[model samples]
Target: MNRFLQQPIWRFYDQSISMKYNSPLESFATDDTLCQLVGQLQSPPTIRTWVHDAAVVLGIQDHRLPYVQQGMKVLEARGYHPIVRNSGGLAVALDTGVLNISIVLSEQAEALSIDAGYDVMVALVKALFPEAADKIEAYEIVGSYCPGSYDLSIQGKKFAGISQRRLRQGVAVQIYLCIEGSGAKRAALIRDFYEVSLQGEETKFAYPQIVPSVMASLSELVDASLTVDTVVIRLQQILHDLAHEVHMEPFHDEELTLYSFYLQRVLQRNAKMLEPK
Candidate 1:
């Protein structure tokens, strides 16, 4: 286990319930706000879990795709809202089955190394599923969207990817866990997205050649009956045991104002990125 995951106190934020009403944009903005609040010592270390109905979160580099808009249409046609996220990574599919977790920690004492932050998330995830402790592996899964060095996998099939955002002396390490549905199906969507976006035309950046077979959900990899709700329960139990005090704290009035500011920025950036080129 990483030292950062052993905080004495932790504030839990559960947004998984109201996922239908919230967009991925709002979630990203809330993360930014939490980053500021936690970094400034206004709040304790926080763990936020969220899920969105369905969206194709594109990375900044992805916005430059030759036929990006056409590719977005392919997603929208399939009921997936397309939006370029404020973080770094290639496009990732999100739906009711996928669980997104964010660990917001302050970096005031000393800046946490990038690798250290990623390791913290890897540790927490392994703790989440003890039965698969030895099975779970972290390495890049080629042919998967948003391929990264810390891609979480089991038996060579990826089920999660970790990305980090640092702002205002805080580090937000985020991961999307494919918990319930078929992970390969989600990867297929990204495969179609990239196929449409690239149209076989070469570009400066090398977009992933997504292979759907390279991914599998936790349910498929470990237990067929696993679900987001059950995973959430496990998360709470783990947090309770790890921290001396674990509780949910509502947003402060000041924090709400700050959240609004960050929300607008995210919205504006998305609008500009998705506009016709």
Candidate 2:
């Protein structure tokens, strides 16, 4: 048994229920909020689930594109609002069908290594879909958007990607799972985004040469119709089976107040990221 999958306690938060913080900006802030709390020992190791409607969360590298303004405009035209995130990844499409999970953990004695954080997320995902446990592979899917060593794929098609954020004394391991809808279509959106953002301009950074066919949804890859709700249920069941105690507590007033402060910081950072050059 992987120790990463043997977490004794887990605090669960399902934002998909209220659909309140379903926007990209709110989603990022929510993670930051929980990360700060857990890092401060105000909360336990946490697992949060959220889904945004339509947004493209870009990384710092993507913001430096020669024609980034044009790319943002392109995304806006396509009904996907673009925002640069405080994480390490290129442009990734987010929608109703995509499920985002954040595992926030406190740095007990030593700082968690980056690879260790990613491994935890990978283990969590595999645990969530134990039926397809061996099928999940963590490797960079060449030509996939936001290509990374931890891009989660099955067979040859990529469906999810893991990224980590560390703050204070906490680590937030995040994964965006394409639970439903057309994964190739999402890839195409990023491909077009790069096309518009780069506009034949050369740069020090190497952007991904996205191949839409290489990206797919978990539903398509597993050959089973997995909706966001269905996956959330599976997550709850998995946690229940794996953990000795699963805490599902609503945010208190103090937490909400602290969240507002973190959210404000995120908003300001995003506004600056989206500002015209």
Candidate 3:
């Protein structure tokens, strides 16, 4: 299956400007908008990059924990807005120091497998940093928030996690790359979130017992001063090199309208889950 799938098969569309919303909520809303566009074939497959000021995106499982509300309170007190995401994975940290990218592709292209989607993003990362790419490996990275087989790590320290959102016939493979700042501190935030949400109570599902030291930002892991902006630029360079022609444009007004619908749906989903019994 690996050899049969062509390299660089996905069409690349880049959004020109960063989203208007400084909050993660708005960023997520934009992702849904793009997802719908790609799903409907109204837009080409895209590789969009975005940054949120400071936010903690909680997974659906994280919301089910008995004391998630209290965990959110801690996030709020620390000046980070918390919002639940419509994807897999546990809680993850996002901020100006982080770079979030989504690769929206057609599922019909070639029987898109879950691992294939993950590898596409992994391949992109490897191309971007060839020097450190060899050191980049995928594993559970135990003790890391959102532990998964595709967790992107270097020397045992995880710097990024991947998730997917599939719509009608389109697949959006997403990853949050921690480019700068203290990776351990972000992990600590999630560690504390679990502590608050679980309060040491055991549950049917085993949540990761987070060890902050296991996660480090790309800058820390590579021993180079890297910023989100720098990483974004590198991404652009790679896209240009790979694509026949790359255009940076903003979402059309019509696309924004679709996003409005998806955003409302996301809000309603969260509302229904939070409703009192």
Best by lDDT: 1
TM-score of model number 3: 0.91
RMSD of 2: 1.4
Model 2, range 1-277, lDDT digits (tens) per residue?
A: 4465556788999987575335677777878888888899898788999888889999999988999999988999999988889988889999888999988988865568899889888888887787788999999999999999999999989999999988878889999999899999999999999999899988999999999999999888885667899999988998888789999976789999988898899999998987888
**Predicted candidate 1 versus true structure: per-residue lDDT over 1-277, tens digit per residue:** 6788888999999998876457899999999999999998889999999999889899999999999999999999999999888888999999988999999999998689999999999999999999998999888999888999999999999999999988999899999999999898999999999999999998999999999999989999999988998998999999998899997876789899999999999999999999999
What global local distance difference test value does model 2 have?
A: 0.87
- Ranking of predictions according to lDDT: 1, 2, 3
Query: What is the clash tally of candidate 1?
Result: 0
Compose the digit string of candidate 3's lDDT tens values, residues 26-118.
666667777777667777667888777668988878888878888888998897878888888989988778888888777555567898889
lDDT of 2 at 269: 94
| Residue 238 error, candidate 2, Å | 1.3
In candidate 1, stretches whose alpha carbon ends up further than 4 angstroms from where it belongs are none
In model 2, the number of clashes is: 0
